[model samples]
Every structure is written in structure tokens, then in C-alpha cells.
Target: MANNTSSSRTDAGALVRYYLLRAVVAAAWVAAAFAIGVANPVAAGILLVLYPAWDAFANARDAQANGGVRANIPQALNTAVSAAVALGVLAALRIDPRLVLVLFGVWAVLAGLLQLAIGVRRWRTYGAQWAMVLSGAQSALAGGFFIKSAAAPAMPAIAVVAPYAAFGAFYFLVSAILLAVTTRRRGATA
Candidate 1:
């Protein structure tokens, strides 16, 4: 009974922290995007890169927790690839922001699909399956929008940085809150 209770508390803690991280990261990226301006594709790319890094650690941790095995191999691999692509886009931003954005959009779409595939198929083990699905869908849609925006060279002067900064901000905020709540729950149970 004691062990079970402890395990439950542990799981709750992980859940809360996960959500808090997501919220914070999202909000920060959105803010960065808005502040940096659309022309500053490098900044935007940097912001996007953060997500994959964060996810890599999170996935690795999760894999360890589940069975000391790299269970989320696909997620980890996809995040790595996404990060690399984002970096490559950033490197080319000086030449053309539009090009960077287009690449970013492509990366986002692929990452979203990969995440959705993993989440849908392996959701039975996770408590926040919907959140994963939602995140994946959002990524796909946002990627598409970015691609379209790049295609429309005559479109309004919107800041590309806004999306990234705002996303990071939101991600961090939500993640922090979730972590706090989980901490409290864990404490109570403990």
C-alpha cells in the first residue's frame, strides 16, 4: 500500500512538471517571435530549436522511467532531426528569411506528424494523451501557415519572432503551473 501510494505521487509529480514545461516553452517562443520581427528568421529558428532540445531531455527521462529503456526512441530521434533542421535554417537566414521560414514550416509539419504518430499509437501509457495530440496538430497547422506566409511575399509585415516568443512564454507558463500543482499533489499524498 505504501509503495503504491508513493508511486502514484511520483507519477503525479511527473505529470504536473510535464505540463508546466510545455506551457512555459510555448509562451517563450511566441514572445521571441513577436519581438524579433519576421525578418529575423534566425531568432525565430533559435526559438523553435529550443522545443526539440527540451523534448529530447523529457523523452529520455520518460524512457528511463518506464523501463530503463529508450521507449520514446522515435520522439527522441525526431526531436534531434528537428533541431538540426532548425539550426540549418537559422544558418541560412541571413541570405533569405523567407527561405528560412519555408524550411521551418517543412520541419514543423514533419515533426508534428511524427509526434502525432507516436502519441496516438503509444498513448495508452501516458495520462495526457490529448495534450500530445493537440500539440502535434497545432504544430502541423502552424507549420502550414508559415509555409503559406512565405509563399505570399506581398503579405502584411508581421513579425516572425512573435510566434516563437509567444509559444515559449505559453509553454513555460503552463509547464510551471502544472509542475507546481503536481508538487502540491505529491506533497499532500506523501
Candidate 2:
């Protein structure tokens, strides 16, 4: 019983660190996209592609830390989807820049659903996953909007996508804080 408590504490600590890291990276990416990438097409393209690749890497790492890709199937699938989206974005950039938004929309919808599943699963093992679940649902809704907007004649700029990252950062930060509070309360009560 003591060992279980200790293990859960360790897991909670790791999750806190992971969430903080994710939030920071996402915020930084958004800042970079708006401050620099927006001005330079090349830079913008790189940032666009990097976003999903980073998500893939982040998801994969988180899955490994939690219980490997096999145990975290939703994250594993998210990892795969994100990586594929990265490649798709790269191709779209070359073939037709207009396709980038479409690709992002598709990825957002799929990734959001996967994230929702992961959050639901995590909530069972560890509390304080409400923010994650909310983020996932929001992402899905935003994706539909993106898809509808993508049909417009003009190609959207990097700035249009930056806000999506901002929301993700906000939710991640909130989730991290909530988890930290929950973990602290558990410690105090124990």
C-alpha cells in the first residue's frame, strides 16, 4: 500500500513536470510564430511543419513516461497522426500552400479526439484531467471552423494558426496547475 502511494506520487510529479514543459514549449512556439515566422515565408513554413512534429515528439515522450506506446494507445495514435500531419504540411507547403490549413484542420480534429480519449483514461488513474478534456473538445470544435475557413479564396497566414497554439498552452498550464494542487492536497492529507 505504501509502495502504491509512493508510485502515484512519483507519477504525479512526472506529470506535473511534463505538463509544465509542454505548456512552456507551446507558448514559446506561439511567440516565435507571431514575432518572427509571420514575416518570413520560409520561417513560417518551418514553424508550421515544426508544430505537428513537436506534438508527435511530445506525445511519444509522454506515452513512454506513462507506460510506453502500447499502454497509452491514444497517445501513440496521436503521435503517429501528428507525425503524419507534419509530413503532410511539408508536402502541402510545396504542392499548394492553401492546403496547409486543411491539413492542420484534419490533424486538429483527429489529435483532439485522441487527446480527449487520453484525458478520459488518465482521469481514471489520476484526477485533475478536466482541463485536458476541455482543451481536446475545444480543439475539435476549432478544427471544424478551420476546415470551413480553409475553403476561402485567400490563403491564411501563420498568424491565423498561432492562436490555436496559444489556447493549447493555456490549457496545458491550467492542467499542470490543477494537477499540482491536487498532488499537494494528496500529500498533505496523507
Candidate 3:
């Protein structure tokens, strides 16, 4: 029982930290997109590539912190997918912005499904994963919207995707808060 409690506490702490970091990164990305991505095409391209690269790095870190990739298959797959998407974005930027949007949309859909699976699995062990589940669902929906936008006549800009990052930031913040609250309550009870 003691070991289980300690493990749970460790997991909770790691998740809280992960969510907070993810939120901060997303917020900064959105700010940068609005402030720089709009004015400079090169900056916009870099931002597009960085978004998925960050996701890959974040997923890898989370998977490693939680358990080995084998134990966290969903996150592991997400990390791989995000990494591939980052490379795809780099290639697509040279061809067309629409391609970048399409790649992001596909990545978002896949990553969101993986996130949903992770949230469901975690919910069995930790009760405060509702925010994560909701975030995953919202992410999938946003991906669909992105796909639709990609088909539009006008070329999509990095600013067009800023709202997705904003929502991501909000969800991560909520998850962090939820985990922090749950940890406090568990500590009090213990």
C-alpha cells in the first residue's frame, strides 16, 4: 500500500508538471504565431515545424517519465507520429502551406486518438483525467476543422492555427489544476 501510494504520488507530480509545461509551450507558440508568424513567411514555416516537434519531444518525455515506451504505447506512438509530422511539415513548407495544414490535420487526428486512449487508461488508475479526455476529443474536432480550412481557396497562415494551440493550452492548464487538486485531496486523506 505504501509503495502504491508513493507511486501514485510520483505519477501525479509528473503529470502535473507535464501539463503545466505543455500549457506554457502552447501559449508561447500561439503568441509567437501572432506576433511573428504572420509577418514573416520563414518564421511561419518554422513555427509550423516547431509545433509538431515540440509535441514529439513532450510525448517522449511524458512516456519516459511515466514508464518505458513499451508500457505507454499510446504516447509512444504519438511521439513517433509527431516526429514524422514535424519532418513532413518541413518538406511541405517548401511545396505549399496547404500541404502543411493537411499534414497538421492528419497529425492532430492521430495524436488526439492516442491521447484519448492514454486518458482512458489513466482514468482507470487516476480519477482526475476527465479534462484530458475532453481535450483529446476537442483536438480531434479541431483537426477536422483544420482539414476543411486546408481545402479553402486562400492559403492558410500560421495565425489560422493559433486557436488550436490556444485550446490546447487551456486544456493542459485545466488538467494540471485537476491533478494538483486531486493530489492535495489524496494527501489530506492520507
Candidate 4:
């Protein structure tokens, strides 16, 4: 029993660290986009592309760690598809306000859904996993707003980018806090 308890604590600690790292990376990406603005479409596209790609890679790594099996194959596939579509859209679009908003909005919704799926699967096992679910929900909501704005002829520069940046930041912030709490819980149990 003691050994089992210790093992569980260790697992919880590892989970916490995982989420914290994800949050930090997310926050950094958002900050970079906000600072750079969308002046350079190529740069913005690169940034947008990298985050989901990084996440897909991370998910792959997690699967490898679990004995050569990716537990969330569907979610992984979704991330890959979403990232691909996002890049393709950005590359093909003409940088008009409407197109840019639609691209970002679509990406956000797809990514959020993937995250939510993963979070739901892990909820029973991980205490702070729900944060990812919340983040996913928020992302979808923000995406909806962006899509609605696209119907308009013109949107402010910030309108297109700000939602993405804000949601990314918020998602990361919540993820970080959840990880911190999970880490603390692990320490207490240990």
C-alpha cells in the first residue's frame, strides 16, 4: 500500500511538471505573437504553426513514454490536421482582415477541441487536467467571436490577433496554475 501510494504521488508530480511546461510554452508563444504583431504574415504563420506542431510532438513523446503507444491517437491526429490546415490557410490567404480572422478562428476551434478531448480522457486520472478542458472551451468561444467578426467588411488589426493572443495567454496561465497546484498536492502526499 505504501509503495502504491508513493508511486501515485510520483505520477502526479510528473503530470504536474508536464502541464507546467505546456503552459509556459503556450504563454511564450502568445507573448511573441502579440509583441511581433501580424505585420509579417510569414512570421505569424510560423509561430502559429509551431505551437500545434510542438504540441503534436509532445503528445507523441507522451505516447512513446507509455510503451510505444499513443493513448490519444484521435487527438493527435486532430492536432496534426488542424496545424496543417492552419498553415495552408495562412499561406493561401491574401491577408485581408476577413481571411486572417477566419484562419485564426478555425485553428483555435480545432486546437481547442483536440485539447478538450485529451483533457476529458485524463480527467479521472489527473486532478488538474480539467484546466485543459476549460482552456479548450475558452478557445472555442474565442474562435466563435473571431468567426462572427469575419462577416464584417473590416476588423481592427487587433481584432484578428488579439483573440488568439489573449486566449493563448489565458490557457497557459490556467495550465500553469493547475500544474503548480498539482505539484503542491504531490509534495503533500509524498
State which candidate has the highest lDDT: 2
Q: After superposition, how far is residue 150 of candidate 2 from its true place, in Å?
A: 1.1
Report the number of the highest-TM-score candidate. Answer: 2
TM-score of each: 0.67, 0.97, 0.96, 0.74
Q: What's model 2's lDDT at 124?
A: 84
Off by over 4 Å in 2: 153-155
TM-score-based ranking: 2, 3, 4, 1
Model 3, residue 101: displacement in angstroms?
A: 0.8
CA shift of 22, model 3, Å: 0.5
lDDT of model 1 at residue 71?
Answer: 63
TM-score of 1: 0.67
- Report, for every candidate in turn, its global Cα lDDT versus the true structure: 0.59, 0.90, 0.88, 0.65
Q: Arrange candidates by lDDT, descending.
A: 2, 3, 4, 1
61-176: candidate 1 lDDT, tens digit per residue: 65565554466666666757666765766565555667766766776677777767766754453333554565667777888887888876563223643453355345445544
Which portions of model 3 show Cα errors greater than 4 Å? 153-155
Q: Which stretches in model 1 have alpha-carbon errors above 4 Å?
A: 1-5, 36-69, 154-158, 164-190
lDDT of 1 at 63: 53
lDDT of 4 by residue, 98-184 (tens): 665676677778777877886787666656666678888878787787778878836443436555655665665676577567757
